[model samples]
Target: MEAKEIIEEKQELALALPLPSTIAVAINGKKKSKYVVRWALEKFVPEGLHMFKMLHVRPKITSVPTPMGNSIPLSQVRDDVAAAYLEEMGWQTSEMLLPYKTMFLHKKVQVDVVVIESDDVAKAIAEEIAKALSISLLLELHLVACFQGSAASYSHFHSPSLPMQRFQALSTINRTLLHTRTGSIETNSSRRQSLDIREEESFMSPCPSNSDIGYAPSQVSSARSFLTDDQSWISDQASTSDAFTESSSGSQVNINFELEKLRVELRHVRGIYAMAQSENIDAARKLNDLSKRRLEEADKLKEIKLKEEEARELARKEKEKYEAAKREAEYARECAEKEALQRKEAEIKALHDVKEKEKLENALVGPVQSYQEFTWEEIVSATSSFSENLQIGKGAHGTVYRCNLHHTTAAVKVLHSKEGHITKEFQQELDVLSKIRHPHLLLLLGACSDHGCLVYEYMENGSLEERLLQKYNTAPIPWFERYRIAWEVASTLVFLHNSKPKSIIHRDLKPANILLDHNLVSKIGDVGLSTMLNLDSSICNINTGPVGTLCYIDPEYQRTGLVSPKSDVYAFGMVVLQLLTAKPAIALAHLVETAVQDDQLMEILDPMAGQWPMKETKELALLGLGCLELRRRDRPDLKDEVLPALERLKDVADRSRDSAPKVQLAPPNHFVCPILKDVMHDPCVAADGYTYDRRAIEKWVEENDNSPMTNLALPNKNLIPNYTLLSAIMEWKSQSNQ
Candidate 1:
């Protein structure tokens, strides 16, 4: 059923109940509860403690209103906020009334709290007085009782017209206040109407319908009450007291006739009222328990707060200690840095003192050598007065010149206006290169730093990239030639990797640094970007700064800031893949369009080298893929991969040789063979005439050809016995004998 129907049915059930003399407490007044209780005790003595049972009879009101026309369900809002506040305060409390039923409707309602306990003695006495007045006036002042619906009807009237009008307007302002403030008036009006309907019906038909079929109504058809005591009814006042017995009518029946009639009904009313009052007392006891529990909880909460505050203070002290330690460390670091600066300054001064001593020594020694120096006239004659054609190049550091010095062809790098030695970087490069010698590396012939010049063996060919990538040159280095070039470059790296005083890592290995000889062989040209690792120290250790170009950088090294020989391996793999594909490293990325799944590897190989047997090629590609694995540990050692790859190439060559056709063989001799003796006189051995070649026929003829002239006549008889075997044997001999 819908909510309204369920509610109506519940109200109807309450209405049909046979309650004894009932007293209603209207929640519309401003009287204090304790004072009201005292008044109720004195006035409605019959109702007594049963007043508390009215807690169950909450009513639904439309709305509440304020005098200024503002409206709200103020009672409900208050209850909700109060509930939340109570919960926040850790109160173990429950609302006895539903939120919907606990509101009062009033045009100018200002409600704080509402309570409906069973009417006590004072209220019950007032109700009796009203009933007696009605009987005397012969005016039927209906005391509407029982539950009524929202709309006013004759049955169980709940609200008087004057209060309802005020409530309707008040509900427009505040709905909650209306229901809470006027709950009793609303309930009483509706309840009394319901009682009147039941009373009228009880007289008209004491027994409700029995069908013509003679079936009686069910026993539960009528409303029922629970009280069963009959002796509790008050006897007639005249019969109990003689003072009221003075009348000729013998006042036993007349003086308290009304009271005697009430005594019967009031017996049950008084019981219900007593029960309600007991409930109120129990509620007061429970409220006391709740307040006690709340006090205990508050003490516990205060202890927890004290502990939390103590923990926060401890944490603050620790933080302060940590800050102090951090500051002390920073001060210590500053002191150390200051000491280092002072030490470096001292070393610089000592070196300056040594330089002054060396200059004094050179001053004494060079005095005689100064006499052999060329005069301005001789210098002018040698250089043809600074000819423009002699200037070979200009740079940020200096000018380079092509010159014939002591009848030797050389390129001279001269500083533009040097009052000193070359730049520290240039001098460092010179020092390193002068000590090193390799056929493929640049050779430093001499240095004349006093004159700011460096003389070296000149390279006629430009960089390898210039030769390969130049547009006009159009030099198509064949795949084998490119492989040879890559091998030469790899050999150079291998030498560097194993160099003494430790291996030097080329931090920037690229095509631009690769120079080519006249034969197009690769030679590593630059040592400026090289780093020498200490041989005694761990190999392939990380350095602080990031090294290598974006395209050539190992992703693992980039992510982890670690450098290793494997990092070089990754870069070399990139260069190798680049050379193999004949594409620059930037373009090499395009080939790796997707992940290198085993099956898709062929797609990543150089498309220029038309499909070769890919089993080993794929294996090689996988080696490159391993170098590119995100983890540094998975990449193979360069020597391990290179040696196997060379072996694979050798195997490919061997297989190609085996697949070639064999030369034709000379015809075998039939005269010596018993199987072929009959055909010995044949001029040629052909496919149609020979039963088998010398290799197979010799065995066959030896077993079957048993004639006396076995050497001269091969077996000419047919092996299978046919219907015309003799003719076949004759034809075989004629064809074979030559």
Candidate 2:
């Protein structure tokens, strides 16, 4: 069965809700925050008196780190200058409220400004600002008392309106708030209408819809008084009728009947009013339930929106990941392709290099190829099938064996196994080694074609690299010997570079390739990475590819991919520095340069290399730094500038070695002046009374009035002749064969 329900004259009334009493605005003392306050005022601020709470969330000040240095955030304001923190905040609040103060005063608004110093608000400052901009945190809603009513509506006050032309308002209200809160008998007469309203309605215009909603005891009492007054008036009418009834019967009867009808109609109206009020209570209950359901639906919609936003953010991240993955995949594929192409090109270049090496080796063979050749059977017999004990040394080129060949103790170098696959670098090394005849160059004796073995004269020592490091716990090389070794390497390099038709550039110039004999004489050993170029206008050997160790490679050659004689000079510079300091080659130039600039070069010298001669060592270091120039043109010419300097240093080292047994102290080192360190020509004394050269002391006094030896202030610029010291120096020089 279908059931039907109906509400009779119970439709919901369309009435305005209570206006918000407070609009809480959050400010950050920023210009954008003022825009937010202005927007709230223009948008939906109701047509009623309101209180705006200007809540400013002051940021907590602190220090943070940056690239340049540690810095404080916004360090403009000072506590002492601004009186105190509270007063400063007050000033800031006033500054922010400057724009809207006039408008707010005219409107029915009051402001209660406050500054809150809280870290939580500072942390979520962005969120708070957004909430304020959305007006979600600005306005706080409350169900205040029912809205004020006007004269035309169900009003209880009998207040009268003033004359329109005069436009005067006379209000005697206690101003506890904007509107009077207490005192029942308050008078307000305005030109338009009064804002004060009463809870109860007029008896003649009773709104039954609002009868049971928030009705107080006062309203009930007022209703009872109106009913009692009506009853009194009816009783007075009845008494008059009774008096009239004794005098005139006809008129009294008609009056009595009309009075009874009026009483009946009043009772009927009272019954309807009571029933309508009861129904209004039920309707208000139903409306409250509906409002709750609406709020729940709104909450559900907001949750769904949040979920959708999260999903969109996730999808966007996924798209970015996919794009990044695609790019990585493409890059990996390109790298694979490039690696394959490089491997192919390297193979082709290897084949071409082998052919060139073979042609050059054949051309240079002349009579060097006539050396005694050992058969494969003889080599196997001598080495005991290449026994492990017979092996003397192992290197990148091949293995060396101590074997007796042709009644001679020879070092036989054999190529690696399965490397009969003929290579380019080894052939070049063979061609150059077999033809060169320098005492500093390793001598090649013979070869075994079957296994690519070459016989060379045996040297008791290993290589320059091992000797410098003292790899087998050997004694450290003395400074004088290292100086001579540097000289030999330079002169030998000059020889190869000045070869007859074409010049040879040793691409690999490092310590490992230099060999040392029993006498500790160093020789350039490996010639594999070398290339011969035509002596043309071009300085660098640009015909061959660049290949060498990292630190020894010249900067210009590494940048432009060309090999030149100057490149060898650069490597020689690094070698010279290593000999002086005994440090690793990596960043050696930079370290030495910094030391020299700071005048700490003496501190960094190798303590193992027996007490270095100070003057010669400094000169060598300066020369090395000059040779290590970044540009090839800036470097010293190997033949002209460099060779002459090395020869001079070598002569000093040779004299020191040759005269080890002699006590040569005729002209002692102390005879020279402390400042200039030269034999004092015109010896003199200064105010500090130290004997010094006349010119050196005068220059020092001119720049600074201080003693050169003691660094103390001089009394006066005086040069007393030190004739006695001068006579000793002169007699000593003459006796020393000057």
Candidate 3:
């Protein structure tokens, strides 16, 4: 009763439990089974277990021979054979259990293999399929095969049951219990009657008749008899069998309850699977969308990089262009600067040339001309534009050039007149030279009025200062020639001072101003400091300031600023001292006067002036001393004392020259002076048919008023030029130099 009560409770519990909404049905492809599918469809699928997926695992197909004796491919054979077998096995087309491929409703859902047989190949294939699908593998028996399909075939297929399999087993067990209950009751009643008879025989006899034995045997046969006649044993056997039936019934009830619980759990699990599958699909979609966006972003980044590279390339090209343009501009600027510098240099050179030409022109022309005007151009052309080769001499005033004008050779004096005072002095010199004309004086040939220049008759022998002071490579002038030069210069001074209306005071009378002609005759030139004094009493007393060369300037004239004819006499005295000593005028001036006063005339005499007459030299020295007196009034008068004394000295020199024995080694006649019989530095011709030293003839002309050779009264004191003799002398000199 307890067992029945427990069974009733379990049956109630099974009815109360929820049913599974899904089940897995595995069919056997080898058996061509439709029963497995049908049984699952009728039993579990109809109970609203909608997740009924049929897993029909086909056997691996083997190569089969065709009618043509060619082998058919295994895959084609399996498809055709499987479909045909299922159809022959009475599988309805309308009851279409979805194919195995369609069973994968959720890719993530775990698959369980309900293997119908324990075939290793099938198990391996199922494992491989599980691995390929990335799902779990569960080896299981086909539960429906155990129930509906031939039980004899599945008799060895023992496996743990699923909820559906266990529920089917319980139903089979419940049906068997109905038939076995009547048998169990009949056995129980017979066992009880045997026990009552055994108890009544205990009071009767121990021994029995044949009828008694027969009754015992019938009762024993009525009881489900055992080998022993123990009453306890019969009762224990009946109770034991009853307990076994009750335990079996109880076990079936518990299994049914558990199966119903598993169904409910399976339903819940299915719902979970469905929800998980839906979420997985959404997540996959979102992941796909994100991948697309990433692709697009990558493409955009690639485009941006390309643009940046293009921009960089363009900038680089622009920079190169800018650099190229800069280089071009710099080159152009440098070229322009070089060109400008070249042009500026050209302009400066041109300006310098113009200035030099202008200077040359001014130096060749005189500012004031009282004679024939010669164009500066003609003078430049004549002197080859004052080439350095044509330059004969240079002085404080200007340079002298030997130029040939209109076939007449002359000395051109170009004055320096850059300063205003020097320019005025130039004009004054021109005026003075233009007015003065004497045989013992320089002759002005022509002039250029615009430029400060004077053209004079060229003197071949240079000056008395050059001959006396410069003793290089030349025979010294004899005492007679020295005397002759002194006499000529004295007479020239007389000529200047004793002019007609007014005496011309030559303030600067030095040896340099005393020039020599080709005949070595002294002629006064460069009267740049000469000024005229009127013979009238008022003008005769005029006091002019000191103006002369420093060493030759009279001491009294310098002190008192009194310039007179006596001033010329003082300068002439300095020149005489220079000729006696053959020294510079300034050097002699400092010591000569003191020497002469101390009676040291012979001590200071130039040894170059050979065979000097002591008496005559002393006389000349004393006369120079009188002229250099400190007071102008105490100075010797040129006409009364200086002139007459010089004339007597000239006569003495000539007589001495005549008395001197002729040396066999005398110079050639062309080189010798006709009067002095010395090598003439300055040779000039007289109208009386003689080429005499210029100083000798001028002195002779002044004192005797006639030529020495002819002893005739001359028509004019003008000397004719002896070019032939002069040329011969120059040629001889050049040969001698070589």
Candidate 4:
């Protein structure tokens, strides 16, 4: 039959409109690519949606580049990544899609995922969906398509001049099932339904099912009518035969010959009837044979489709194996490269550290600032021979003691056995601390390097890290205090970077090294790990390897071992983030950046730091993130970009502190209601002359006729609003919020 040609003609006008319900989103096995699925779900899933399918198209790679500028076939590559996620070119479709599937399942949505390997992503997706639709519906759909063909075929059969009741009846049947190209074997339920309908039609018609060998009821009716007419004519002829009998004696002889002739014609008619019956039996046998052949062809078609599906699956598995092996080889090559790089870095670091002291000492002309070199006995007397009671703290280089030296309160750092790198650290710290003096830098009083001791003006409150961590139950630092500390640290770093003779890089700038006094004035300390470079506009000094706390280390310096003013900038950025959240320095920059990007800055602000101003806090977060650029060139200059912004925030913070209520977080005891034992929302003077919350006083008056404060019996239940107390309470809350 012309099934395919006829269907294609009809398809020309079928209008293949874009089906929003069947959304096709392009994605891949890359991190964050699931957002495409999310976008499809949010945008199209709500609009009368039916099926949501995810499509991933992997590329086919024959060969990959080698480290030596050579090429290797992908088949030769090793397989070490997860076998399940592997594709021919190392595409990780299933590994990436697991999360997406879980998300869709949670949303109560059904989805089909296609992982295809073809360079043409769009074409692959198109053909895959088409294949899926073709075999899914197994019904009389092809028959539907034929009905849509030329109407003239049916119109010719229905012509009034040439048609009888049967042609009109057959037109209602839409032609025989065998006329078409082919059909799928009917399901048992469908076959039974057809049989039931045929039986019902037989009951409605006068002819029995076996009686009509012809196609329709019209042929059977015509044959029955012709038989009745012929019988009536024969009866009329028999009644006229007796009247003609007397006219023929010779006619009788002719009648006998006519009888013989009639008998011969009957025998001929019998022979023709027998031949027709034999022909009918042959047609029935051929019909059964054709039916069996049709079934076998359908089974073959089904087998072919099944084999095609199996082939596709096999190809997918092979592709996955190839990709996994490719990745394994790539991973191995990367590891080798990394090992070589690390070995080189280690050799450089060892060479740099060995000559570090020499480079620094040679670069310096003797100490610029001079001070008394105290005798060993004097140091011993001041620190009580390094008594534990005198010892206030200890650090990486030394133990510190509170001492009275030269009639001034001082912090004396006694070197811990002064050996190896410890000696160099002490001398470098002493040289830098003695030469430069700033209000925001710890003041160096004197040093006796001979006895391994150095003294400095004492700071009462210890380091900023202690305050932030609330060590020893110390009260949390106020937000304004932290703001000023950030500003002070920035300004001090800039001063060191811009120092006249050379720039000093605080290789280890962290909260623990920042000291605060009784008034909470922050100062930078611990110049032991500090490195000074020769006068150069480049402001970068080559070092062996990165040095400092890993959490606050500059990422660039940690990688390349290049020291610059920007390295200090990177560390200072982390310090600022810690000040804002009171969080640990590790990953603080990432957290703040993400929070700022999501507009969730206020959520991470340290709530303990009373009422942080949102405008200043977000700006501080942004500034901190800007300082933490991974590349040194990308970081903002400490003197110009970071300090100016911090200075403005400091000024705003100062105003906020000034405008805030002086009573810390709570109101004065007079603002408290006697009945409620808490600050009154609305103060009212009771008859007993004590102010109470409006609701509290009313409730008390309802149950008790006496005052709650002095237990005095009330003569009258009259109460007056305490406007003066109410005003004070309102002012307190307003200032506290500001």
Best by lDDT: 4
Candidate 1, which segments miss by more than 4 Å at Cα?
1-424, 447-460, 472-474, 539-544, 556-562, 587-590, 593-620, 643-738
Off by over 4 Å in 2: 1-370, 417-422, 537-545, 661-738
Query: Across residues 287-386, which tens digit of lDDT does each residue of candidate 2 receive?
Result: 9988999999999999999999999999999999999999999999999999999999999999999987887887788443646788988788778889
RMSD of 2: 27.5
Per-residue error (Å), model 1, residue 64:
99
Instruction: Give the TM-score of each candidate.
Output: 0.31, 0.39, 0.40, 0.41
True-vs-predicted CA distance for residue 156, candidate 2, Å: 99
RMSD of each: 34.9, 27.5, 41.7, 34.3
User: Of the pair 1 and 3, which is ahead by TM-score?
Assistant: 3
How well does model 3 score by local distance difference test?
0.63
Q: Comparing candidate 1 with candidate 2, which one achieves the higher lDDT?
A: 2
Candidate 4 TM-score versus the reference: 0.41
lDDT of candidate 4 at residue 543, scale 0 to 100: 47
Q: Candidates 2 and 3: which is better by TM-score? A: 3
Task: List clash counts for every candidate, in order.
Answer: 64, 0, 17, 4
**Global CA lDDT computed for model 1:** 0.47
Candidate 3 off by > 4 Å:
1-370, 537-546, 587-590, 661-738
